[model samples]
Target: MTIIDGKLTKHYARVWDYCHELLRSNPGSTVQVGVTVNPDQTTYFHKMYLCFKAIKEAIGRDASNQVYPIAWAVVDIENKANGKWFLELLTEDLNLLDGGGFTGLLEATKEVLPNVERRQCARHICANFRKTYTGMEFNNMFWAASFSTVESEFLRKMDDIKEVDPNAYENLLARHPHTWYRAFFRTDVACEAVENGIAECFNAIILDARKKPLLAMFEKLGCT
Candidate 1:
């Protein structure tokens, strides 16, 4: 089901039909949730329409000879993307009881999918970390700490950051490095991404479509 300008928009696509099957095959898949502002659409309840996207990976082929994990089962909805209301609907529809997800949507995930492995995007954290700390040395150290796969290596990298700037090290700690650092991520999911690149890529694919009128945007997103 798709909503546009607070109205239900019905569109038939095989993606919805195969959503269950795809998820079944890709058990424990990490879902990336993101909200993109739809500037061209608005309603009385909101100033800008929010396009909520939920994307996961599946075994598929982009070209005849290429077989790899591709992003599929993209859920695009036009509504207020904040709060747990939309997330509840999405999880109910997809039957996503437990999985991994980005930290931006952690609160809602806690309520809807409490067992989900919460991961914060290192890129987003770095953006905030840069506000108070800026320099090639600080940036390099921060990333090194995030990418460290071993506990000792992670601590060594963090000590490097601390030697450069104690405040910067404290800031990263406050943001909960456990959620963003690769060393703390669960091995059961077999995912190593410290960023929400999949969700961003899906958003980019619908960038132009999101600017269209309500119904038109739904059509494009459903078909895309």
Candidate 2:
């Protein structure tokens, strides 16, 4: 345990010191600290991302051989600033070229990765659709629209949705066809990935860790 000024470690030790300790212990690790500026020139705690060497190596050098465990962060809040900071650090650490054959999906990723082709997670898209529309038919229609690899096939499924419920079809349409529908997706990267299930899996695995203090959370996430 690290000692503080005349006391043992508190519920939460200083993040600044801990980040340094992490870097010292793990060589070739990337740690980024972000802060929010107040009107009075004061700064507030934001979030941070730690991309250890192990995580980077696990992702490999190319999509063909790469695993998708890119990086993980402990975000205090999922706001615009924090989102931008996390991706910016990731981009810098990964050294991904501007037009690198890569893509990111969802809100936080969208905010920073402006050039990379963005798509929607299939499960998330379906879950959001279910909030307003129900029934096995709608689920099938949604998947039909998403998994359709040909333009004509995609249109046919979309039309099926329109026939079932014009309002639901309109709602889905409002969410931009290119963002989720596979037919509209570009294969330049040859990623061939349509779902963000791996990222979601981390969410489940870290659900308990998220409730821990920042330092403990970082330690827990670093473990196998």
Who wins the lDDT comparison? 2
**For every candidate structure, what is the RMSD over all alpha carbons to the true structure, in angstroms?**
9.2, 4.2
lDDT of 1: 0.60
Per-candidate TM equals 0.64, 0.80
For model 2, what is the error of residue 36's alpha carbon versus the real structure, in angstroms, after optimal superposition?
3.7
Candidate 2 lDDT over residue span 1-224, tens digit each: 23422222343347788878878988888876666656677645546777865554323335464335657776656677766776777788777545256767656566556667877777777899998898899998899888899899988998999998999889888887787777877878665556776666667777876666667767777673
**Overall lDDT per candidate, in order of appearance:** 0.60, 0.71
Model 2 regions lying over 4 Å from their true place: 1-11, 37-43, 54-68, 106-111
Please provide, for model 1 over 112-188, each residue's C-alpha lDDT reduced to its tens digit, 9 standing for 90 to 100. Answer: 66777877888888988888788778888888999999899999999888888888888888988888888988887
After the best TM-score superposition of candidate 1, give how far the Cα of residue 83 lies from its true spot, in angstroms.
4.3
Q: After superposition, how far is residue 7 of candidate 2 from its true place, in Å?
A: 12
Deviation (Å) of 40 in candidate 2: 8.0
lDDT of 2: 0.71
